[model samples]
Target: MTTLPAVSQHNPWTTLGAEVRYENNWIRVVENDVINPAGNPGIYGVVHFKGVAIGVLPIDAEGCVHLVGQYRYSLEAYSWEMPEGGGSPSVSPVEEAKRELREETGLLARQWRELLRIHTSNSICDEHGVIYIAWDMDQTESEPEDTEDLIIIRMPFARVVDLVLDGAITDAMTVAAVLKAQLLAERGQLPEDVAKLMLGR
Candidate 1:
């Protein structure tokens, strides 16, 4: 059985004070003095995101999924995963997904569907991530942002699943979306055309 959220909500933690520790174009960090749920006084630092994160898993007609590789500043390493970016909270998540897909791979998907909604690091950050599956695309030249240096690759969707299982792809959104897509295929939950395309490869 599943338990859903109640219509009424209550907050347990009480904040004594809050101060901004840092701010950037994308995120803001705040230090909050609070009384814990257990009645202890402590400080909690939180990273607040300014925009919603968007991720797109674009699979072509031949069952090839597009991946983007780039150097991650925070990790100081190169990561390969689904094409993803951030979108203004004012815009629809699906619209941002389309933009990210187009910017990273220059592919416009004819069909799009959401895959998952997640919070990347809820304990220390308030960042919302939305993952999507896109198919039946038209390919063209990529127009990456000036700050982005990306490498695009097209490979079998199954290979992406292998990478996920092998821990080679650790991006939260990518991991979730790829596994979800596989599960959907296994359970015959996807569209007849999309499922056949994914399972076929």
Candidate 2:
């Protein structure tokens, strides 16, 4: 008989106490007093997000991508990014993605494929984000939220990739989606028709 080594999955940090520093409709701030993984006493602050973040990269049959530009209040700078918003926890992610696409760019995609899922920032918050690639699109009048004043631009998908690589696009979700979609197109990992459009073939 051979003995095998035990692989244990266990939590390392010991939570001695926790306090809610602040909370709002979108997030909650929690301060935790804990013993660290290194066994040192310390405190950790966490921002708990209320909904899933959704991002959509809408590519049309003409090998063009739609981008949205807005002045981010938090960053205090202008940013160009894929259509994105927070999805209500009660709704399906794809449904949310569809709604965000239509609201932000006024385009409805007949075909939808999920491209990536990631943690936006794990160190401070547990914000989960999902990105989708949309194609076979129909354009209509946009209905942006009252809180948003946006600018929409349509350009070649390749140009969008260049913007990301050239240090223009910084939104985490947009960056991840564009890079992943590019990789998929290059590796033949996407649907033949969609990949052709994305790669401008």
Candidate 3:
């Protein structure tokens, strides 16, 4: 298992605060103040995040995985990624996953399994992303949010691994989720018992 290095050793900086300089629906920039490990105080910089969420290898009735291609303003282009979101104050992570899946791909799963909790960027942000595995999915009409413009693509389960190896899919959380699901499936532990419990089956 790969673990992030301790903050104290990874960066020679301790944050004091990030004053918001600008804010918008898509992004926000902040000016930060920090004290370097060498005991030198100086002005630093970082983005204040509103957080994000990601779903793992989703398995459909035909044993296919669903992926989405959407434009990422930060990246300045479209990229293939799993269904994800920033989560709503009114919904739990699980609910958010379901919503994102339907919104982005017009799919709904009968079962959902949590894969892991990952920090998208731990160095200077408060963003924590939760990964989940969705299976037994059924297709439905998409209900994308007003801000979303996504295209859905379904690929063979085997092809997902190939995409990762070929560098076609580069989103860290998506990669982690797919790898984790593969690991679990190989060990005969896929769709963990807890997930069955969630589905009341």
- For all the candidates, what are their Cα RMSDs to the real structure? 1.9, 4.0, 4.8
Q: Please give the clash total of every predicted structure, in order.
A: 0, 0, 0
TM value for model 3: 0.80
| Local error of candidate 3 at residue 25 (angstroms) | 4.9
Clashing pairs in 3: none
Worst 10 residues of 2 by lDDT: 1-10
The residue-by-residue lDDT of candidate 2 on 103-132, one tens digit each, is 999999999999999999999999999889
User: Considering summed lDDT, which 10 consecutive residues are worst modelled in model 1?
Assistant: 4-13
Give the CA lDDT, 0 to 100, for residue 2 in model 3: 95
Q: Candidate 1 has what TM-score? A: 0.94
Instruction: Provide the lDDT at 46 for model 3.
Output: 62
Candidate ranking under lDDT, highest first, comes to: 2, 1, 3
TM-score of each: 0.94, 0.95, 0.80
Q: On residues 1-201, what C-alpha lDDT tens digit does candidate 1 reach at each position?
A: 599877756678999999999999999999999999899999999999999999998889899899999999999999998999999999999998888888889999989888889999999999999999999899988889997899998888888899999999999899999999999988988877888888883
Top candidate when judged by lDDT against the true structure: 2
The list of candidate 3 runs beyond 4 A from truth reads 1-18, 25-28, 192-201
Highest-scoring model, TM-score: 2
For candidate 3, the per-residue lDDT at 7 reads: 67
